[model samples]
Target: MTMLNQMKKSLGLLLLCTVLESHADVLIDVTATMVDPACNIRSENSSSPLAIDFNIINSSELNKSAVVKDFSLYISDCNFSKSLAMVLNPKGGSTLSYNGKNILATSIDGLGIDFTEVTGGTIRALEMNKKQRIYPERVNATLYRMDLQAQLVSAVPIKQLELGEFTSTVTLSVTYN
Candidate 1:
């Protein structure tokens, strides 16, 4: 009986060794992107939820010329970066794309708003997620003032303009390199 038990133990050990030997080696590829930390974003007035009031827009005036309002964003405490961009995403997924332009749709029907980024005398219309260059060149400054403008645009014919109190909300996000 002792001899038989010893044989069974030896056989079990051999099977365990064979099972261990059957294991295969695995190679894994690891990757990661090193992103610069985000900077502090604030309204030009150093307040939350930057707002621009297009006070008392005359519906009839939209046909004469687009109503324009200027606003600013104050950026500070930013990590050293070579460049940065501001991405505009209007809330509620409201937007109007007309004639090769993207406009932010407002609460009022037939009315929309267009945005332009002003950088050092150069003004360019901002496209959705186009990553428009907020920094013309590499910058290391800790404080920055980003100037912008909002222009009232009509999605429908001027005759179809809606009259009432209106509101619009857009979330501004920053990406840095």
Candidate 2:
């Protein structure tokens, strides 16, 4: 309507934008309660260990195929009032060396664990860097299952084969919408 009014509105808009921008994405230190989960994962391991062992894989085996183990993250007794999502911590709980593809770093060089979500999609390093494997589902009246697969892989060209143990534990957390 008026030049002065228009200038004032623009200034207000600029101030609003600056304020919003400054307030964006503050630091977050996440802590999991574990005391109450919308649902509980059921597995045979009573000690709360989700692990797989590739017993003494040869160079050829590592080169040819990836050793894989199947595990399911079953959610029982879901009490989510709204939709929920399950995210696997990008670091997988423990920080171990990683191959180029973000697979678990092995004790010996040129070895890694090719992690994937058989039921969902390919596994990446994390949500921010790569696509984090997340399973989102509507609040259901029954149990929900997320099946995952991991493989022991070797680089195409074998440099040196060292005998050692490779292990990893991934931490998982939940968020609601």
Candidate 3:
């Protein structure tokens, strides 16, 4: 056979064998309760809004450094004793969209916020940063404390800092499970 015909024949045989191969299908199903969990937070300090303020800094210093602050979440008085953890759902609409790491997304030009999962840590990209699990064993057990730090980062190159307000607001909802 000619080269063209020989190549076509080989291709057809490969396709036919591939189609004749055996195969099986698999399926997965998931279910959950429609009723919400009775894990209503027993504390009330969840009202006060947490704010991170990076007081005015010399543009030169800001361009070369990061400003960090500590913040906390307080929850108390669980109806029952149990171990629970919290997950934060930071509000979207930020131009600094986080790619699932621990970086904070911001809209302010030349600036971004880095969040560290608790105090005494490096600022991280925005992700489902969870607070350390807490067990409420008593009516007033040590309140659920989620200590976190927010750092003001400068994305600008050295000595290219822009002078202006650098701020980001996220309406995060914490779910305990």
| Per-model lDDT | 0.78, 0.57, 0.55
Candidate 2 stretches with Cα past 4 Å from truth are 1-38, 44-47, 77-86, 90-101, 120-133, 136-140
TM-score of each: 0.74, 0.54, 0.53
Best by TM-score, which number?
A: 1
Q: Which window of 10 residues has the lowest lDDT sum in candidate 1?
A: 132-141
- lDDT tens digits, residue span 85-171, model 3: 545454664534333344455555656676655423433333444453443323245445545667666565645655676666665
Ranking by lDDT: 1, 2, 3
- What lDDT tens digits, residue by residue, belong to model 1 across residues 1-177? 999999999999999999988968899999999866777777757777667888987788888987998877777766545577778888887888855877788898868889988756689888654565685322345677777888888878877876889998888887773
**Least accurate stretch of 10 residues (summed lDDT) in model 3?**
119-128
- Any idea what lDDT model 2 has? 0.57
Q: List ranges where model 3 is wrong by over 4 Å.
A: 1-47, 77-92, 95-102, 119-142, 158-160
lDDT of 2 by residue, 1-177 (tens): 599999999999999999888855779899865644555665535347665666776667766666678776666665555555555544533323445444454555666566566555545333212335345333356766666676766653565656666555555554453
